[model samples]
Target chain A: MVPAPLPQQLADLSDLVGRMCTHAAGSLQSATAALLECRERLALQVIAREPELDALRVETEELARDALLFHQPVAGDLRSVVSTLRSAGDIDRMNRLALHVAEAVQRRHPAPTLPPEVRDDFAEMGRVAVALAVKAADVVRSRNVVRAIELDHDDDAMDVLHRRMFEVLMDPHWPHGVATAVDVTLLARYYERFADHAVAVARETVYAVTGEEPDAIPI
Target chain B: MVPAPLPQQLADLSDLVGRMCTHAAGSLQSATAALLECRERLALQVIAREPELDALRVETEELARDALLFHQPVAGDLRSVVSTLRSAGDIDRMNRLALHVAEAVQRRHPAPTLPPEVRDDFAEMGRVAVALAVKAADVVRSRNVVRAIELDHDDDAMDVLHRRMFEVLMDPHWPHGVATAVDVTLLARYYERFADHAVAVARETVYAVTGEEPDAIPI
Candidate 1:
């Protein structure tokens, strides 16, 4: 096939990022579902797919570097290219976090990591985390800054859930022993960090569009 | 003062990356010291310096982006700029991992996280982690591909330590409670991940110098 024009190549790159984002979102969703359901097969699938995400991340970085060298795109175009490159790292991190969740489930096998009392809280975390991942994918697909900007609120919710999980762990009356508590703590962190990466993607998207960071957003 | 030429600017950028690497190394060392000694004040100092790392990271990234737009360097120079940008992220992550170690220490102030039995293991981990980080910084400063390539071996040692830690955790006679186990798990992860980031910087430095990834290096 004949190579397309530079603009077309740029579009292809953006599309590739979108596809990767969708894959990341799917991975997190499936990983969480597997964790909740104790499905080893699903969790294994998520773990296996992580290499694909790593490959895609490498391709994205290579393509971005090539575009910089070949097109020398400047200003907004430059920002967009940089964002595409940087966002791949964020997406890849989300994929790794998802894999961590999957591995946690796989480690416990048929046994659920979460206890009965805290299952609902983690379930809520999984829901919000998957939703936030999907929203992040949507932002990449549409390049809609408004939707991208809304990710922070979802991320904040993830944080609250994270804190609540910690509170449960630190509670004096906590019934779960150290092993289960450790699992829950790590699981909570995986979800929270996943959400953090999603928010990072949003921030990069905003920076790409505006050439400035979101208001009061820390580096 | 007059702004430096592009060559000088590029050198300045690399110097900045080196400075950031040193800071990251220092943070890891200090944080590990805090963990080992259970010194709240030292841990607090490490936490307080994290913002400085964040600022340095942002500055390195900006300098890299600006250099790209203004200088449009190609080939090795372009790779250098990109490496500096990417390596800054690695360094920043290392700093964050260090902060986690420090915070873990601060949270359990006046009491060490690792039990008497595992304290020696973690102390060894801290030592290896610090050494690996220093080696990574040296590679960055010198752009020595051979030295950079050796980091994988150091990283391998870290992985062994990490696995040894898990072995202890999973042992039938393991005596530490879940909270302490969780703390040790996270601390081990922090060290292993810090080493991983250092290896990443080494890999990037190798690529920057040779324009090719090291042979047989698994992604």
Candidate 2:
């Protein structure tokens, strides 16, 4: 049970965590934006921002942990704060991964051979990655379990999409050659992990409320 | 604060969520088993087990959520339960993703031109996936924050391996066209995500201990 005397502390902690989630989510968005727009400057900025977000993650996690240890909260309170702390880490890593992709892309501009048929295929991967990060942030701040759950179903599509991405790269007729193939490899990874991490944030949210481990769930 | 009357409930809920996580981690291991031994039956089993695990996730999440609504926990309690529930989805998805690769690998024998290489990569990826999954389980059950924090660094290696796997695929001299390419895509996604979800799990663990986000931490 929430201690009647602790409202101010709870609100402060929640707000700080909420901001952490928002910033982490913003980093994800910036990473994808850097990718989609091919803005080297933006990509650099995203990469630069990585350390700050990482710092925030560590900071928030420490605070939550300290609070948990010192206060030894009730079942519900303990679960929520602990998960938030955990999700912050998830959010941070996901953001860093996104930044990694942006930098990888920036370091080597490997434009995939767009056989008119594969027009938006690569772009779609970037879009999805950004979308996943955005959803993860929402899950953290709002703790919307249903929204969090959506990440699971949508992730299958990521598998499917990346498979298609490879197919396009492997096509012998593709004129761009190895560059297209290499680009597919890196970009596909970014999207794959993006979806995976988003689902991670959601899993934590569900855990926050349910105290259930993710392994027990139906796949 | 820790509720005076909820210790039993806390233990019960933690045990339940921990069970789910344990199974989810096992599923990842089992799913990888399909590739390590190249046994189609093993792969099938992993897929078959997914639905059961999925069901567990849903049930536990609902339970945790109900608890949250019914009883407000203090910081530590909230973090514990919430991290468990949150991690459940990531672990589940990781299991499913590994199984996705297993299920596909189960479908066909690799072409001879490079079956050995593909097999090697698959086995390695599976090993990596299982390693991460196992560690995640350890983190949750043992409440090991350092191990959780270490997961972030591990993902970087996963990404490196993914790129190396790609190099093998694009060498052109490697032969066994089209199919090997597909294998690379699938295996790459699986390994990459395995690392990612592991990082997510670790992040949550750190959060459970410390209130910092990734960007905020010095690590």
The positional error of residue B202 in candidate 2, measured at the CA in angstroms, is: 4.4
Of all native A–B interface contacts, model 2 reproduces a fraction of: 0.07
Per-residue lDDT of candidate 2, residues A1-219 (tens digit): 443333344444555655665665576667666565566777777777766765666566556645554565666576666566556656665776677767765776554123345447656766676677667666666767788788888778778897887677667765554534555566566667767767776787787767666444553
TM-score, B chain alone, candidates in order: 0.94, 0.84
**Which candidate wins on DockQ?**
1
Docking class of 1: medium
Q: Work out the TM-score per prediction.
A: 0.91, 0.66
Q: Compose the digit string of candidate 1's lDDT tens values, residues A72-143.
A: 888878888888877787788788888899999898998886688888887888888878878877787677
lDDT of 2 by residue, B65-84 (tens): 55554465656666655666
Best by TM-score: 1
**When only chain A is evaluated, what TM-score does every model earn?**
0.93, 0.81
What does the lDDT come to for candidate 1?
A: 0.81
lDDT of 2 at A33: 63
RMSD of each: 2.6, 6.3
